[model samples]
Target: MPLWFDSHCHFDFAEFDQNRQSEWQFARRVGVSGLLIPGVTHARNLQLEALCQQYSWSFALGLHPYFLAEHEQMHFEWLDVALESSLACAVGECGLDRVLAVDDAHWQQQLACFSTHIQLAKRHKLPLILHIRGCHDEAAAMLRRARFEYGGVVHAFSGSEQQGKAWLDLGFCLGIGGAMSHPGAQKLRRTIAALPKTAWLLETDAPDMKPAFWRGPANSPAAIPLLAAMLAQLQGAELNELSAQLERNRQSVLPASYLIREEPSIN
Candidate 1:
């Protein structure tokens, strides 16, 4: 089995509510040493903390823009408490999403929320795991202006090489997921091939962005090796070498103390 790290996932989501423990065990059997769970909203902070304790995986806590309707002012205060807590690893799942038809007022509010996450991350010296969609330019601008020290990956990245280059230059890793597994994803496959190993991170975005092969049901982190194999083939690199590179890239961003165990030997 290839040693791997799923840099992003939502194991706390209801999809695995019934058998979340079994899911983690399956991931372990498949050689996934560690997984990072990003908090999608305030309500999930406690749930995610419990998940980290239960599964022994790290987690990030923040407000997701998609749930802005439910995010009240009090949530920020709650966020402060969550960030101060030992269970929190990073701050995010926060960023712009133009596809959701957000009004200008709400959009600005999201930006404010995003900025708050950045500030809290800096204060606590933890990395951030971002969720950027249709608004890469705006997100990049905000990231550039902030000049944050601890950086993180841009989850479910589907962007141009130029955009990717900008993020890479800004100390961010580009997260590749099941999106590139599709035969129709030529552009994304090309980007995956072009990205330097150092600038790449692996993710599943499970139960949401299902890969090409697994269509009907929600995707799971266990599909990492399948996608990693696909990505390796696209880059014309051997599976072991590619997995090693990805593992190193993941560890560079993930907390050092995370996933301490006997990792599978890639070679």
Candidate 2:
């Protein structure tokens, strides 16, 4: 199997609680050498930290827009502590969303929380793991206004080619997940094809965004290779070639220590 890494996975989610160990082993066996688990709620930091540390996996600490209501005013201080410590390698699963933002007040709250995550990422000198939805323009504007220098991955990117380029211009990458495998994702596939392949990351976003080819009870981190295969076909490149480029793309934004194990030999 070609080497692979899942740049954004929620392996800590309850979906795999019963078989986390077995599931992870299966992932590794399938060539998924690493997974970057991002925090979605403050209450799960330590739990996420412990899980990642236990398996020597990489993780990040941040408040996701989906769970903003659960985030307390004081969690930012706690988040700072984790970021300053050795607990995290990145600073988010943070960004704006249109579907969740029911009103101006909710949108403002997402903006505020996303801004805080951005500032935290800047302060710690870590890349972000953004989660932008329909508000790509707004999110890109915020990142530009914040002068976010450290580039990161934008989870589940559904933007047009222009929007993808905008994020790329800011040193950010678009995470390609199971969604890219859907028959109806022609636009997303086209956008990926148009953008430089170097500006993408492979991820499962497991327990969610299950690929069309997947018929399992839930998505698994192992879906990375499937994603790689799809991307390979999209780019009309060999799997090994795509794998090597994916590794390089991820490493450009994240440090080596974040993903464990030696990378697959690239030739």
RMSD to native for every prediction?
Answer: 2.9, 3.0
Best by TM-score: 2
Q: How does model 1 score by TM-score?
A: 0.93
> Clashes in model 2: which pairs?
none
lDDT of 2 at 78: 91
Q: What are the runs in model 1 whose C-alpha is more than 4 Å off?
A: 260-267
Quote each prediction's TM-score. 0.93, 0.95
Question: How well is each residue in 142-213 modelled by candidate 1, as lDDT tens digits?
Answer: 877887878778899999988999888777888999889877999988887787778788899877889989
For each candidate, the alpha-carbon lDDT, in order, equals 0.81, 0.86
Q: Indicate which candidate wins on lDDT.
A: 2
- For candidate 2, give the lDDT: 0.86
The digit string of per-residue lDDT tens for model 2 on 170-244 reads 988789899888889888888888888888889989889999999889999978887888888888889998888
Residue 164 CA displacement from its true place in model 1, Å: 0.7
Which runs of model 2 end up more than 4 angstroms from their true locations? 262-267
